[model samples]
Target: MSEMVSHSYPRVALIGECMIELQQHANGTLKQSFGGDTLNTAVYLSRLLGSAAQVDYVTALGDDSFSDAMCQVWTDEGIGLSRVQRLPGRLPGLYCIQTDASGERRFLYWRNEAAVRECFTTPAAEPVLAALPDYDVLYFSGITLAVLGETGRARLLSTLGDARDRGARVVFDNNYRPRLWRSVEQARQAYRAVMHEVDLALLTEEDEQALFDYSDGEQILQTYRAMGVSEVVVKRGAQSCLVSVDDRRYEVPAHTVQKVIDTTAAGDSFSAAYLARRLRGGSPKDAADAGHQLASLVIQHPGALIPRSVMPV
Candidate 1:
């Protein structure tokens, strides 16, 4: 297979939901915004790849003002919206974040009836599924699986198979949230099913430990290797990241952030930069370096998205 970055331009699609994000301040003020793990990655990926790749976000949204604003922001970031589904009468989910003095963040979610939960199950989803295979890359996270529910997940699995058969590479982010599923066993089953189709997996070590109870990095790496995933990157915050590709291993140290103002999208940003660099012809090590570089900058900001002016050159 050719290097992902070898193509002059490629089409990449990311699947997940974006919610209305509120940052609750110590003074009890709330700053309304929008963010989601996959959406965060999409924004950063589009920024990093520029015109070199066509980045699209695939999700269901309400035909409300919040959805309108979200679409506008995505367009401003150069992300394509052809794959987005706008459900009538429904609204996007909402979440609020509170950060401690140490800059650690906690979240409260209110997404049960979000339009994205019916994303792949609705009648309108059929055409979107049909067009997914045309992209060069298909990316989604574990949160996506949880929101899709069983029926949507089955449809997604079938769509993944067809996309893979069409030579589209599948990228997965292990953004596991236990509260999203009925039980750990159910989440495990869903993750296992999706893992089989993943070509590149960007995982956080702590999420692996929480989800699978895996003892250490070696076991996690071996499990992904067993799943036939050719490339895996284990992100360890504040420590070195581990990369496994074709039986070779590389340890790339993370860039240290002097003070983390907010760690909201650290992993998401890292995955975006890593994938963007790889798509731009950087080697695994170089890609990891890019991931760390971007993540380091992101943590200095107060939200999931930093200003465009502060973006690294």
Candidate 2:
């Protein structure tokens, strides 16, 4: 209800792995970049907010060449790296995105050995965990939890509880990866526990359906609301996205794009812009529109991150 730009921007942290992304084109050439759901969101959120907000990435990467390149990209994008850790000999995950003529994407992952798996359990993680409560906003995803293993997930959940108690808004993006878990029941338990601490939730309708077998998006909305989430957003790809806060619900359509080169990070960027707008005091509807606009443009490009020169201001 207040003007977003009127107040000082808040600090936001996004936690997840930044994997080595390989995109293969029809011409047999491969494009290289670093991407992960939360990292992608952090980059776009930083780009959208600029100096208005402080954006930091929270993850662990290897001290290898690929990880070095990844950090360089993040630094150049103006993303803070204070919370990012480097483990010796451990490497980041690798994933390749293959798209068909219809712009549909298929992912092949090799992330079982990523350094982020121990991100929350390392002796060095104590300080990071303690400092989390100081952030204005803490953002993470299903993948963030899954990659951490059970002990790490428990630690993270504890931090989320503590952070929420400190008046920091905990935002969750349900980027569920079925293969990451041993079984559906295990994932449901983990997500349900963390869901209780989430103030803002960005959920993809499809992922919810896949993970929880929700009859529809409306059921998913009701489920999150029952779990005490203050605001729940449902993203339906090229379709409309729904937002609900308490008893009120708003339906907003996604931007219609004539072309979609790759869908890599569309939801991730959308979440970033939405949170950035909300942190700056923009209304929920305005934030959703900003999200859709950014995602539409992102899909028109080839990778999770577009060139900074072409980024939205």
Candidate 3:
């Protein structure tokens, strides 16, 4: 495989929500931390890139202590926070995770009134939206679309178009949550609206099936190709990850894990590593390998983030 040309010190911005995360144990105890899909990717991407690139997170949060703690964590991880908005009299979302013995997870959320729902709709958001197009890369997920509501989604779509027009790459992760939308058709509409603006799509086979009722991976790839997406990666848990770049296809095998603990942030971490490797000029196969390796390590831990000391060298 040919290596992608490396870009110099790319500035990346990830847009989404970060919530107060609670890990519910079998003994009825709860462990509190902060996590969200885009935020998790931002943290991992910053750690992987270090001084090689700039990674920033764009979202709205309340002035609560939880929000304070979240900002501190992001700051310590080397993620830029110049675009974060603090809204008064509001709070971030909250979610509780329950993990099965096999490391599968179920989430219970109380986020309908989260401050991020107004992320791109607030009066203060005009400057943030105006600044997004200046970045080298913009990243967001299906959950971001769902949470943004109609007004916020419209603004985000416009910003994405402007970003692409200004020569920025737009990376999208199809992390679909059925309950987040009022109906399947609504979710499909929102997804299709943003698909055209996406440059690279990191998708899960299961999410594609559940969201679009596609029969197989080929259908998914064909659909993306038809939509003019330049590069696409399909991640299948414990199986090979399929990559389609410049009309060339490759399947990279996932690393084996003997024991699984928590599956939280598995795909998020994978996407981060894949993007980081690609930014460093790795081939698609090499990037997928990096993704699988990091995802394997992340699942062995208990939360969205593992201790920095255990990061692979």
Candidate 4:
């Protein structure tokens, strides 16, 4: 394999929403916080990359107090919010998580009216969409696409095409949620519309099976490769991750955990660390190792954003 090549201080824009997160404790108390698929990735990416690359979050939030707090947390994490839009008379969405004895999580959402749904619909979003092509990498997930609605998804697709034309890499994570879409066919159409423009795909094995009903791992890889994606990583919980770069493939085992306090953000942290390593000139194998390492530590914690102190050096 060739040595890793870094992009030298590249700009990354992660597009998604951050919601009010509540964790129901065993004592029947609720602990409030914030989390989202891409937002969790943004936070972990910022922590891993530090000042090496410019990491910005692109999403719309309400002018409410929760939005204010979320922005502050991002700022503290060294994630840029210059592209974050503050919509008026709107409120961010909320969700509560219930964990089973095995630390597996189930979420209940109240996000039909999230401010981020208008992220690309409002008049102010025009400039933001116009500016997206300026970044070196643009990252988003399935959840990000789901909340955008039809009009917003159309706008995002055009923006992605434009961005790729300007040499920006488009990264996508297949974080599928069946409840978010009207129909499976609708989701498939939306995914297919943008797949051709994707540069790197960070996919989960279960999500691929659940969404497209792929028979096995090979089918998933073949589908993405056929879409012209140059890089693909298939994450399987507690199993080895499969990586395909061009014509070559590699299997990197995940880090084992003794106990899992919570299973949330495992994939998000994995994607973040993987991207961070790649941007720093690490090989695909090294990046996958880093991903598994971070994810291992994350699942041992209670929340999405674990304390920075426990971070691996």
Candidate 5:
């Protein structure tokens, strides 16, 4: 649980919302695509950090044609759409998914007036929240604070406290939905207001037992190391994947899928190969074994992406 140097390229960004999917099937056909959970972890962290890193995805889209094929599939998966935004008569936001017989899934949304709920509250989001504090990693989730309501989550918590006061490295991904919040104490006060500008959380022990009901996984890793979050990571889908990292703890193990068929972006491709193997330096148990070997090859494939030549080398 050490090695995390990272910075030969690192620029990442990933805010949220990128809907327009459909899926359905069971003989009642459908299947269009383009997912969300932080755009499926920004298309698997731009196909696992292809040029070392510079992911970029922010959000807000419209000028239809499914927002120009979701910006030509994030510009053919190299991501970096210079912080996308498009608004005008707005659109982007829709869902469907259905999957039964074990691959478990069931959404249905239509996104309350999407266009990323005014992505950071327009005025062209004040230069995309002032160039997102010059990113070096700044992911987003908990369904991006339940679709950035309260004025785009107070301008994304003041651009995540000025991108962690310049040292950047926010990263968080609880993913909880609870019918897009309005209670559960307003999603635990918007997840304790960004858990003190989180520095790598990636949680999901059933979304910390349905948002802070804490059914002890060491009390959700000592409540995200008592809210200072110095690398937490819980995951736990098909068992083992703990990794605390600052007071050291580990767990790992999870890759025995004989068949899954589609658990829709299994934890967004295991938080994109555990943040592309911890931004390439690897070692939080080798980035949770490259996030359980790319979420056991993305739930044996179906949607939420999986086919950049069946990656994983």
Candidate 6:
């Protein structure tokens, strides 16, 4: 691993969906854009890594206007699209975000038929999975698992085992939304089944308590360690993030901002920079620092994918 592109660099792939997001304006208008957890991470990581790392997105989408815009956006951000699949008849998901006067946002989803839902189980995914093991790092999230459904989930689990066996490091972020699953127990089992294969786990303390009902942050870290994740980051909004790597723990303080326009993707961006830095051979503390630096700016933005100009250069 090398921090500089002139040296060696790693190829990292983020697997998930990108949806057409509508942020309703105060005047009853919709500000349309694209975003999702792993997509946000992919964009942020590409910005953070620049040419030093090869950041690609692995997912399936329909041949529609929204999907076209997404592909263009990824290309503009320098994300490789060699693994993206465009399936016929199927389409990307859409979500609307409505905010109150105080800037609290509410979401409504329409993703039951999204193409990425069957991305893993389709014949097209075979080549993608085969190529995945060659990458240095593979990233996915809880939403990805939930959306993949039963058959896709089973296929993904097997692919992950093969990827891990082939030396590809797996990274997971626990972004738990109750609406995505039928029951908490179902999500818990899915998370536990995949946790052992993860090399790094980016967790939000609040989400952990919601999903697994951990007693404390210590329990969260201990539990992830038991799951065989050597590196675990516990994030709490506006507070310090606790990172456990190897046998050492570091309390990395987050930057304070005057206000948070929207807290969306704060953890996603943090995970991207943290993994990007770590993949570049930067120290764990340095990676944590980079994570916080990127996340601080993200919290100040109005959406999940912020203006690229504001991103760290």
Top candidate (TM-score): 1
lDDT (0-100) at residue 158 of candidate 2? 94
> Which is better, 5 or 6, measured by lDDT?
6
Badly placed stretches (over 4 Å) of model 6 are: 1-7
Q: Lowest summed-lDDT stretch of 10 residues in model 6?
A: 1-10
Please provide, for model 6 over 141-237, each residue's C-alpha lDDT reduced to its tens digit, 9 standing for 90 to 100.
Answer: 9999999898888887887898878778888999998999999999999999898888888999999999988887889999888878888889887
Model 3 root-mean-square deviation: 1.8
**Predicted structure 5, TM vs. truth:** 0.35
Clashes of 3: 0
Candidate 2 local lDDT, residue 295 = 95
RMSD of 6: 2.1
In model 3, which regions exceed 4 Å deviation?
Answer: 1-6, 99-105
TM-score of candidate 4 versus the correct structure, residues matched by position:
0.96
Q: On a 0 to 100 scale, what is the lDDT of residue 102 in model 6?
A: 82
* Cα lDDT over the full model 3: 0.92
The number of clashing residue pairs in each candidate reads 1, 1, 0, 0, 1, 0
lDDT of 4 by residue, 64-126 (tens): 999999999999999999899999889999999887777567889999999999999999998
Residue pairs clashing, model 6: none
Off by over 4 Å in 4: 1-6, 99-104
Model 2, range 1-313, lDDT digits (tens) per residue?
A: 2332234878788888889988889887998877788989998999888988889999999999999999998998899999998999999999988878876778899999989998998998988999888888899999998999999999989999998787788899999999999999999999999988998999999999999999887998898999999899999999989988767888889999997787889999999888888887778888899899899999999778888787777
Which residue pairs in candidate 3 have backbone atoms (N, alpha carbon, C) closer than 3 angstroms, thus clashing? none
> What lDDT would candidate 6 get against the real structure?
0.87
**lDDT tens digits by residue: candidate 5, 180-279:** 9978889888888888988888888887797778886778988788888888989888888888888888898998998787777788889888888888
TM-score of each candidate?
0.97, 0.94, 0.96, 0.96, 0.35, 0.96
- For model 5, the superposed segments whose C-alpha errors exceed 4 Å read 1-13, 24-26, 29-34, 42-58, 61-88, 93-122, 134-136, 139-165, 170-254, 263-267, 276-282, 297-313
